[model samples]
Target chain A: MSDTETLTRLSTADADGESVTLTVNGERHALRLAPWVTLLDLLRERLHLTGTKKGCDHGQCGACTVLVDGVRMNSCLQLAVMRDGCEITTVEGLAEGGRLHPVQEAFIEQDAFQCGYCTPGQICSAVGLIREGHAHTAEEIRELMSGNLCRCGAYTNIVAAIEQAMGEQAMGEQPAARGDGR
Target chain B: MNRFGYSRAGDVAGAVRERAANGAAAFIAGGTNLVDLMKENVARPERLIDVTRLPLRGIEEREGGLRLGALATNAEVAYDERVRARYPLLSSAILAGASPQLRNAATTGGNLLQRTRCYYFYDTATPCNKREPGSGCPAREGVNRIHAILGTSEHCIAVHPSDMCVAMAALDATVRVTGEGGERAIPFAEFHRLPGDTPEIDTNLGRDELVTAVDLPAESFPTHYTYLKLRDRLSYAFALVSVAVAMELDGGTIREARLALGGVAHKPWRDREAEALLRGQAPSPELFARVSDATLRDARGFGGNDFKIGLARQAIRRALSQAAAGTPQSQTDKRVQ
Candidate 1:
C-alpha cells in the first residue's frame, strides 16, 4: 500500500497526542492512535488488513489472533499503543514471494479447515504453536491449540496437518532419500 | 469504544505517580483484561500506564517463601519447577483455567485483578452494582446461576473468577504492592475483600497501587493437595463449583486441613469451621460429609443457583476422600514399598 493511503485511513487525531510506530509484515508505519484503540481494529480498519477477523471482541474467541513478536496473542485484547516498536506478523505476512507457508500447505493437503473464516487465525495461531515448540503429543497440541476454537470440529485434521508439517520439516533436515530398503 | 490517552511507565513508582496524576488512568499489563473491558465500555480510563516492560518479572525462592513477580505469566507460573513442586496446588489451579493461549497471555497479577465473569457485569445494558454503583445488581433478581453464594452481600453476588487465587488463599499467600507509600505486603486472605456494603470494591488495593508480586508462605504440612472444578463444559467454561483442599492425614485421622472454594464466593472462601471440624478427626465418609456440610452454613442461593450449594458440598466431600485415599502411605502400601 502507498503512504498516502495509509495516512488517509488513520484520520483520527490522537486525543492525547502520542505517536506509535509499529512494524507490520516488515513494513514500518507510523500512526497516531488512541490508547483505547485495539490492535484488531488497527490492523483491520487502519491498515486495511482484513485477514484477521473479530469474533467475540473479547479474548474468549481466537478469531482476532495474531503473532506479536512471533507469539500468538488476541489482538482484540491488546491496545495498538502497547505494540509500538514490536514486530507483528499477521496472517497476510505468512507467505513469502507467493509461496504458501508449510502450515498453510499442510492445512490444504489434509483438508484441515471447513468454514474458512477461522482458518487465517488458526493458521497464524498454529505457526505460533509450532514456533513455541508446543506440538509434541496429541494432548499437548490439543492443549496448546485450545485457544483457537474451530467450530467446524476439524480438530483431528488440524492436529494431523501440524504433525505432518513437523515430520516434513524434520525430514528436510536429513540426507536425501536412498534406495536401500534396509 | 471511547478514545483514551496512553503513556509508558519507567517503573512501578512512575506508573503509580502517573496514575495519581491522571485521575482516571489505568495500568496496562498483559492487556488480557483491561483492553477488553475498554472496548466493552465497562472500563473507561483517560490514560493507560504501560508497565509491561518494567522489571517486574521473576519467580524466586525467597526467605519467607515463593515470590512470584506480577508480570509472571500464568504459563510461566504453572510450569515453573519450583512452583510446581512447592505449591503444586497453585500450579494445578493455573493449569485448570482458560487454555494454553490464554495462560500464555495472562499474567499472575492480571489474573488476580480480573473482574468477575458475571454475565450481568459485562452487559452494559444490565444493572450491575459492581460496574455502576447503586445501579442495583440484576443477578439478584435475574439469572444468577454462576453468582456467589458465600462472601456475598444483599447488593452484589458476583463470584471471583480465578482458579489460581483459590489455591493461593489456601496456601496463605501474600500480595506485595507498591504505591505512593512505597512497598507493603498484604495477606492474600485480606487482599480480596468480601462484598459487604461496598460490593464495588473487589479488593483492598489502593487506586494508585500496583501488585508487584505474590508471596506463598512456607508451611510444613505433609498434606495431599487437590483442586476439583465442576463446570458445564470440559474446557474454557468457568467453574460451576470448585474446591481446593490440602489435608494431612495421620494414619486414619486428619492432622491438619486447609480448604478454599471457588465459583461459590466473592473471594476464595476458606472454611475455617470445616477445618476445625476435620482436625484431629478420623477420615471417613461420614466425617467428610460433616466437614462439607459445615462449609455451607450461611449459603443463600438465588433461584438458578440453588443446586450449587449441594454441588459444592459434594465436591468438597469427594475431594477430601480422594485426597485422604491418595496419600503417600496408600501409594506405598499399594506398591509394596
Candidate 2:
C-alpha cells in the first residue's frame, strides 16, 4: 500500500473510534481511542497502568516516562498512534515473577522515596540510565537523571540507589536478562 | 488538543508529498515540541505526517565531515564517540539542555525546530504577535525577563530555546533539506531567522521542506572549547544566557575563533564582527571583554531583562577563560554564578 493510503486507513479506520494495538509490558492490547489521545492517557486511563504517574502533562517532567523499544521517553509527549508497532515497558514491567529488579531493590534499601509519587519514574529513568552506560559517578547520575524530579527532595537517596544498582550490575550479580534490549 | 488526521510516511519523497497535500499538515518526528504546542492551542494542524519511520537516522563520516541524519536522537549524537572527542562543544551543549528521557526522545532536527518557551507565546489567552500576528505584543511591556535582548522586533521578543543550535552555529554547520524542489543546503547561520516583522515564521525552511541531516565540517576543536550555560537552576531549566566558544590557539594567540550566544535572541546569536576582534589576539581578560562588548553593543533589553546584558558579558569572559585554560565545564561543576 502507498504510505498515504496506509496512513489514511489507519487514521480513518475508526471514524467513530480509532483503534491502536500497543505491546505494553510484554502484553498486547487493542484499544479504541481518539486521535488526540496521548500514550500516557492510554496507559493510565484505558489500561489501568497507573503506576506511571503524570506529574507534568508537558514534556518538562519525566513522571510519565516509559520504555519504548527499551529506550526511555516521555509518554505524555507521544501520541498513541505514533507508537503503533513498538514495545512499551512501564514501571509495572520492572518486576518479573514477583521479584524486584535490582534498581527497585536498591531504591527500597536506600529509602529513595518520601512521597513515593516520583519513585516509579525515577526507577524507570535509572534503569534506562544504566542501559545507556553514561553514569558512573554520583555527579553523573545526578546530572543524567535530572528529568525525573522529586518534589519531596529525595535526590540524595535516589542517587545512592542508582549507584548501588550500578555497582551490583558491575559485579555481575544481576544478569543482563533483567532488561529487554533497546 | 484538537482532533487531527494522522499518517506515516515511508520515504522522503512520500513525506514531502504528504506535507504538500495539506496546507496545515505538520510532519511529526519526536513530537516533543509540536505536541506541547498543540495542547496549548498555539499550533492547530489539521493533519500530522509521522516522519520517524523515514530512513534518515544515520550518522556517518562523509567528505571529511560528519553527516548527522535528522532522526538521530539527541542522546545518540551526544554520546557518539566522534562527537564527544572531536566536537565536545556540541556534546556538552546537548547534555546541558534537557533531561535524560527528553534527550533520548528528542531528535537533532527536532531540537532545531523546537519552539520558544516564552510565557506569553504559550498562553493562548494572552496577546502574542508570534502566535497571532497583528494581535499586538503584550510582552513588549509585560514580564519579559526571559525575552530576547539581541533580536527584538516590535512585534515579538521570544528567544530561541535550543543549546544544540548554539553549538551548531559556532561549529559552522550546514542543514540539509528536501522538498518539492529537491535537496539543498542552508548554512547554519541562515537556517534560523531573527524575528523581524514576521515573528510568526521561525526558520528559513519552506513549509513543504523537511530537514534531512546536519553536516559538520571536518575540522575538530579537540583542545579549546566550552559551552557555558547559566540558568535559574542547576538542571532541567532553560538557559538565562548560554555561550558556546571554540578557539584555536597558536602559542597563546588565537589563530581562529567561533562564538555563538543563546537565550538572547530569536535565533542563535552569531556576530562575525565580534569574532574578528578575537582573531590573532592573545588569550586575555581584556581582549575577551572587548569582544563581549562588540557583541552586545547593539543589544537593547526590555524592562526585566536589563540584567542579561551584563550577565552575558561576564559569561563570555568566563567561557573564554575556561576554553583557554582547557577546563571545559563538566556535569559536576557548580552552576555558573
Candidate 3:
C-alpha cells in the first residue's frame, strides 16, 4: 500500500524517522529517535547518561525516575519523542561544582542504602519530593517516596535522610539553590 | 514495543480526526498505563497520536461546579486546593492509587480509561475474553483473588482498576466527549457499561469519540466523605476492595448519600437502591451493616476471592461510619481512625 493509504498524512514520522530536541542537564541534544525509544533508553544508550536505572520498565517500579520539567517521572514509560523541548534532570546531574546535593549529602550522612542499586532513583525521587513541598514529616516523606522501592531494605535510613534534608532545606534555604545541582 | 507512526495533534479536533481516520490509532496522554501495556505486548496500536501538547490543560471553575480538562495530570488534580477542599474524596482516592511519579504523568481521562489489571488479560499467552472477543476467560477459574465480585459474566470477571473513577461515580460527574458529527455529555453512571455478553467493550464510549473533559456537579458533599482503600500493600498498589462514601448529615440523620465501590465490578459499582436505604435514616453500626449487606446481596465471588465478599461488607460499613463521623481516612497516614 502507498503511504497515502494510511492516516498519517500530517507532519508525522515513522518509528525511527522522528527528530526531537530535549535539554538534559543544561545540555541540548537534538536526536532523531524512534517512536518506541523510551526517555530512559535515550538517556542511557544514546546520550550516555547512565544514571537513570530501568527496573520494571513498566511504571510499577520507579527505578527509572528522573526530573522532567522539575517533576519526577518514570523515564522508561515516557517516549523520548513525546518530551520534545522539555528539560530533564537525572541522577548523574545531581551534584554541583564537585559538591553533593543536599539530598545526596543527607543520604551519605544517613547511610541511606545497603546495595545502593536503588540510590539514584531514591535520591532523584527525594529531590522531587522535597520540591513538591508536600512531605513535611517522616511519614509524609515515606508515603510520597513510596514509588521508589529499595530491595536492600534501606527505607528507614532513606526516610531519615529525606527528613534531615527537608529540615535543613526548610531553614531559610533559597529555592533557587535547589536543582542547580547539575 | 512495535514500530508505530507518531504524530502530535495541535488541537482536539485534529486529534479526533486523525484517530478516526485510523482504526488502530490510540491517544497517549500520560503513557503511564498505555506505555506499560505496549511494552507487555498487551496493546499493539498501529499509530500513536500525541495529545499531550493539546491546549486542554485548564482547570476552570463553572459557577458552583468545576471543569477538569482531559489533559490535566492526576497529580495536578489531586493537589488542587479547590479539589482538596470540595472534592476531598477524589483527592484521597487518586492519592491512594499509583505512586507520586505515575500520578505526575497520568491524566484525568487516561485514569478513567486504564485497562484492567487482570493477570490473564496482561499475559498474551493466556486466553482472555476481554482482550480477544469470544476467547475463554482464565481468571474465572484461575487466580482471581483480585477479580470482580458483582458484575461478573460467564465470559469475563475482570474489574475496572481505578480508585479515582470510584470517587467520580460517587460525585456524579459527567464525561464530555466529541466526535466527527458533534459533541455530547454522558452521565457518569451510564458511561461505563456492564460486561453482559461483550466484555470487550469496557465503556459506552465510542471508538471514534474523544473525551474532552469531566465536569463535577455543585453538590460535593465535602463535609461528610471518606475514601477508604484496602490493598495488598500500603502504597503504589491497586485496591483489593475500596469504598468511597459521600453523605449529607443533618445532626445524626443522613439526608443524602452517594456510595460507590472499586475493585468489585466492571465499573465503579453502585446500587441506587442501597444508597436510598441510607436516606432519612439515623447513623448506626447496625444500620450501616444492613446497608452493606443489601449492597452486596447479589455479590458472588470466585473461590480465590470468596474472602473479598466478607471484606467488602466490612469495608463498606467502616467507610460509611467514617463518613458519618466526619473523619475521613487520611491518604498520607494510611492509618485507620
Candidate 4:
C-alpha cells in the first residue's frame, strides 16, 4: 500500500469512539471520547476539573493520582473508557462545602508544599493512605507515599501532614473517611 | 497513543473470544505498563478488551494452598493477612516493588506480563529486537548497566523488571490460564522464558490465553525467608540485583531451599542445582559463600554490568544469612545500605 493509503487506513482505524458515564466527585458525567483517552485527560480536559495535575503522562510520577473506588491510583495509566460506572474522586472532590478536608488542612498547617503543583495529588493520596490503614509511623508514611513525587523537596512536610491527618482520623475529629469503606 | 476499540469482558470466555477474534487485539488489566508502552508507540493494539471487571478477583484458600485471582491488585495481595503470615517472602517482594499508588492499580496478571524498562525499547527511534524482531539490538553494545547477565542472547539483553515474579519463582507457584484450547496450569518457573533467537516472545502463554489465577502450594517457610532487593534508591526504583531466598531450617540445618535472582536475567534466574546443594547442610558463612559462588559460576556480563556479578554474589550471601537468622526484611525496615 502507498503512504497515503496507509495513513487513511490508520485514520479510519483510529476513529472508533465510545460513550461512557463516570460518577466523579459525587457528580455524574456522560461523555463521548476516544478509547485511548486516559482518565487524567478526561478529568482535566473534558470535565474541566483541573485540580489534578499531570506531571508525567506515564505512571512514573504520581501527579495524576486519584481515588478510584476509594483506592489511590495513577489516573494517567487508567483508560477513561475502562473506568465506566466507577466512582472517581479527584483532588477537586476532597473538600466539603467551603471546608477543607482534614488532610488538606494538615498540608497547610505543616507547610507541605512549595511550588504547589503536586499538592493536590499529595493531599488526595494522603487521605487514601489513611483509609488504607497502612501508615502507622512516619517512615511507613514516607514509604507508602513515595508515588507522589514532590520535586521541591517537601517530602519531610508531606510525611508530617499525612501523620497529622492519620492522628485526626483515629481521634474521630475529622469527617468519616472517603470511599465505600473498603 | 493510537486509538483502539474498547470492550469490557464480562467473563473469561468473553475475554478469550475477544482476544482470539483479532490477532491485533490486547487484553488490558491495570494498564500500568501497557498504557505507558502505548504512549511510547512500542505497542499499538487495534482493540483493547478490558478484563478488570471480570469475576477473577478472588483470593481464597484452595486445596490447602492459596489461589490469587488474576485481577487481585498488588496492594491487596501484599497487605493480605494470609499472604503475609504464610508467604512473607512474597509479601516482602511485592511491597519492595513499585509505590503504593501503582501497587493499588497494578494487578497480579499485569505484574507478571510487565515489559522490560530498557531505554532503547521505549525509544522508538532506536533499534530494539524485542520491540521489533530482527531490527538489531542497540543495547547489546550501548549503555547496558541495567541489562541482563544470565540467560541472555545476542538478539536481546533486557532484564525482566519485576520483583514479585522473583519471589513467585522461589515459591514454586503455578499459573492458571484459560485459552481457546481450554484451561491449563503452568509452573511458575516455566511461565517466563529467556531471551532466545526470538526475542519478541516473553512468556510461554499463547497469544489468546488469559491468566485466571496464580496458585501457591501448601508449604510454609515460617522461620526462614528473605527478599533482599538492592536498588538505586530506597523507594520507587527498579532493582539493581535482587535475591529471593526461602528455606526451611531444622535447628541449624537447611531442610529445604529455593533460590531465585532478579535484575540479572531475561527471566527470574532459578538455580535448582545450587539449591539442592544446600539441602541438609548447616547454615554458616562459608557454606553461604560456596553456594553464592556456585550460583554465579556461569554468569557473564557484557561491559557496563560487570559489577553485577560481584554485587549479586554479595547479595546472595547477605540474603541467605538474613533468612537463616529469621530476620527477613519487612515493609517498615529501612534500606540496609
Candidate 5:
C-alpha cells in the first residue's frame, strides 16, 4: 500500500481527529487516531499487534485486555491517544525471543484454551492480574478474571494455570532460611 | 471509536480552568466510564483534560468525618481503615459494585458522577431523554427491566447506577467542589438531581466545577449498616436492585434509620418516609415490609422493570437484617486494608 493509503487505513473517521504515538510490545508507532480509535484498533490496525482480540468492545469482555503500566485494562474501551507515554504489554509480548513466560507455559501445559481466540487476551490479563497481586485463591482468581470471558468453558484449566504460576513464584521466594545466614 | 483531541491538566484548578475555557472539554480520570462512552460515541468530548495526575487522590480524616479525594480509587476508599472501621456500609457498597479490577480503576468521584447504565443511554440508535433531550425515552415502553421505579418522570426512568453513592446518600455525605466561583460543598442528597424537568442536568454542578472530594459527616447513629445489590451476574455488572441501610437499634427496637435505594431512581434515593416509619418501631420482618411499602408507594414502572421494586424491597430487608445481626468483624475484613 502507498503512504496515503496507509494513512487513510490508520485514521478513524470520527469526531475528535487526533494524532497519537504509541509504544506497544516495545515498538513505537505514530498514527492519526480518532477520539473513538480504541487501543484495540491501534494494536491490530496501526501496530499490527493482533494478539489482542475484540470481544464485547465494551469493558464487559476482557478479550481486548492489555497491561497498561503493568495494570490490566480493557483496551477496547480505551482510546489509543489516552494511553500516551504509557507502557503497553500485549499478548504478543508474553514470550521473549523463543522462551515462553512461565504463565504461558503453564497455560499450555494445563490445556487452558479451546478455541484459543480469547486465550491471548486471557493470558495477557492473567499475567497482569498476577502482577497486581490478586491471584490469592480460587474465588479471588474467579472474581479478578471475571472480566475476561472464555466462551469455550476452559475456566477450570485457566484458573489452574494461574494457580500453578502463583505457586512457582511462592516457591522461588522462600527467603533462603534466615537462621542459616547467607 | 470516535476521534477526539486530548489535553493533560496539571492540577484540579488547571483541569477545571481548561473545562471552563473549552466548553467541550471533559476531565478524564481512571477512564473506566468516560472511555467506554467515548468508544460507543455516546460521549464525544472534543478535548479531554486528563485528571489522573491531580493531587486529588487521598483519604484523609476530617474534623467531622472522612474526606475522600475525587481521584481516590473505589478500592482505596473501600479498604481505608477509617472507612472500614467507622463506616462499614461504605466499604460494603463499593465491594457490591463491579469486580476487583474495575473497582481498582474506578474513582470515588467518577463512581458518583457516572452515567446510568440504561440500555437506551448506551445504544446510540435508541432515543433517550438523558442522551438527547426531546429524543424521547424508549425505556418507558420498550424493554425496561433495569429502568427506575421511583423518582422517575415522563421523559426518563433510568436509575442512578452507583451503590457507593447510595451509601453516601444515607450517610449524609457532602461533595466538595471547586469551579469558576471557587470552593463549596453540596450535600450528597442534593448533589444529584431528579429527572423531573431537565433530565440532562444530572447534578447541580456548574460546567466549570470539578468535584475535589466527598466529605462524610461524623454521626453516631449506633447503626448497623449493609449494602445489598441484585444483579444478573454475581460480579462485573451494574446493579438491578440495591439498598444501603444504616439503622440504630435500641434493644431490638429501631431508634433511627437512614435508608437509601439504588437502581430505583434518577439518583441514589434516600427514602425519608421509610426512614421516619422505621424509627421507634421494633426491627421485624413486618415493620420492614411496611417501610418498604412506604418507600415504593409512588414507584411508577414501565414495561419490564416492575419486578425491580419488589426485588429492591427484599434486598432492603436482607441488608437491614444483616446489619442488625451485629456480627463481630471478621479477620479478613481487617486484612482488606
Candidate 6:
C-alpha cells in the first residue's frame, strides 16, 4: 500500500526491462517486468495479491480470472507486458472501503464453496457477468460462468450465488451495478 | 512459459514488419491459445508481436453485411447485435465453443490460428507428427478418440478445433490479410489446409502475413440455420462432432444450402456435392439420410474414433432437419435438440 512496498513488489529480476504502465485496483503502477511474466504471476508472486488463485496455470480453469478494463479475462494467459496501460481489477479490488462486494456477500450466503479455492474466481466472474449484462437467466449464468471450475462440485450453489448477486446488483444495492433489471 | 521478447505494434503494417523481421516471431492478439501453447512448449516463439494495440478491433458495417476485425474478441463478435440478428449461426457457433473467460480473450484471428486439441498433440511426452514433423503420429494407433475421421492422412488425423470456423465455412466468410507483398483475401474454404504430408502446417497463411479482418457477405441464411455441436460434456468442452447448416428455403423446397462439419477433419468439412443433392428438393427424412450418407460415404476413422463416423452422420441429418424446422440449437441449453 506504501510507495516502498509497491516498489518492492514491482521489483522483478529484469526491473529495467519492458516498461509498462497499468492501473490496478485504482493504483497507478509503472513497472518494468520481463515479457514472459504473466499477469497472474505479476499479481500473485510479485505484488503478493494471492486472492486471485492459480488452480490450473493454463487458461482452461478460470481461477485466475480478472477484469481488465472492465472485461473478464483469464489472467494466466495474459502477459504483464501486454496489459500495459489497462485497468485491471482482481478479486482483491472488488470490495469498497471495508465493505464486502455484493457478489462476495452472496457467495457466502449461498454457501458457494467447499474448498474455497475457486470462490474468488467465481465471485470475480459473477461480478463480470453482472457488468456485461448478457446473462439474465440462471441457465445463461451457468453457461457464461463455465470457465470457472469448482472441483468440489459446488456449481449449483455457485450459480445460486451469482443469481442472488445478479438480482441484488440489478436492484442497485451495489454501487458497481449497471442497473440491468432481473 | 518460455521467455519471449514482446513488442506492441501500432498498426497492421508495423505488425507485419515486426513479424517479417523475424521468422520465429509470432503476432499475438488475445494470447489465449498462443500463451497456452507456449506453456506446453508446443510453440516456442522467440518473440511475440502484440497486435492488440492495432486499430483492427472495430466491428464495422461493410457493404450491407459486416467486417469483423481480426482483433475483435470472440465475445465481442458473438454478442454483437448485428451478428446476433443477421448471422445467428455464427453467434451460436462462437458461443458454443469456449467459456466466457476464453471467449473474452480469444480474438477472431487467434480462433482461426488455434492449434488442434489432440491428446497426443498436447501430451509432449508422446510422439506427434503435428507437433514434431518426423516424430511419427501415435494417434494413428494410440489413444485417438478425438482424432479426425475425414480428410486424414497417414501422417496425422488431428481435427481443426474451431466451432466458429465451421459456421464461417457455411456462411462463406472471406479472410482478409496483409503482408510485405501487399493485401490479398483468402476464401473461407481454402484458408485451412488438410494434413497430407506436412502435418505441421494448419493453414495456408504465410508466416509473414497478418490477418486484418474477415468480411462477411450480404447474403445471410436468416430464417433457416442451425449450429448443432455435440461434445463430450454439456459445456466448455471441444466438439466431438459439430454441424453448421444454413439454408434458403422457398416455402417447402430447398433453394440453396451450405453445410459444414467440425471435429471430423483437419479443416471445417464442407461437401458441395452433398449440398448439391438438396437443391430444389423438399426437406424429407430420406433426403436428409441420403445427403448424410453421401457426406460420410468415404469417412474412415481410426480405431478409437470409429463411432464418430456414425455420430457425424446422425448429427448432420439432425442439424439439417433443425435448419429446415427453423429451430436452432441453443448454446445456453445443453439439450441436443
Q: What's the TM-score of chain A alone for every prediction?
A: 0.86, 0.85, 0.85, 0.86, 0.84, 0.87
Which of candidates 1 and 2 is the stronger one according to lDDT? 2
Best by TM-score: 6
Task: Judging by DockQ against the true structure, name the best candidate.
Answer: 6
- lDDT for each residue of candidate 1 in B1-337, tens digit (9 for 90 to 100): 5666677889787898988777788888887877777767888887778888889889988885889999999988987888877777788778778866678778989999988988988899988888988989889889988988887888899999899999898888899999898899998889998888788889999988999999988772334877787888656678888888877777878888888899999998997877899889888889888888889988889889989998988888887876676632121011211
**lDDT (Cα, tens digit) per residue for candidate 2, span A5-103:** 434544554566556788999999887656677888778766789999888789887889899999988999998888888899999999999999999
- Point out the worst 10-residue segment of candidate 5 chain A by lDDT: A173-182
- Stretches of model 1 off by over 4 angstroms after superposition: A1-9, A14-17, A96-98, A169-182, B220-223, B249-253, B327-337
- CA displacement after TM-score superposition, residue B272 of candidate 3 (Å): 0.4
Pick the lDDT winner.
Answer: 6
Interface RMSD of 1: 6.3
Reference-based TM-score, model 1: 0.90
Between prediction 1 and prediction 3, the one with superior DockQ is 3
Q: Which residue pairs does candidate 1 place in steric collision?
A: none
Model 4 CA deviation exceeding 4 Å by range: A1-16, A174-182
lDDT (Cα, tens digit) per residue for candidate 4, span A47-103:
789999889878887889999999999998898889888999998898899898888
- Report candidate 3's fraction of native contacts: 0.93
Collision pairs in model 5? A16-B3, A16-B4, A34-B3, A35-B2, A35-B3, A35-B4, A36-B1, A36-B2, A36-B3
TM-score of each: 0.90, 0.94, 0.95, 0.95, 0.87, 0.96
Quote the positional error of residue A129 for candidate 3 in Å.
0.4
Expressed as tens digits, the lDDT of each residue in A18-99 for candidate 1 is: 6889999999988888665678878988889999988877888688889988888888888888888998889999999998
TM-score of 4: 0.95
Q: Estimate the TM-score for candidate 3.
A: 0.95
Docking verdict class for candidate 6: medium
CA lDDT of each prediction against the hidden true structure: 0.81, 0.88, 0.89, 0.88, 0.78, 0.90
What is the Cα-based lDDT of residue B104 in candidate 1?
73
Give stretches of model 2 more than 4 Å off: A1-19, A174-182, B335-337
Pick by lDDT: 1 or 4, better one? 4
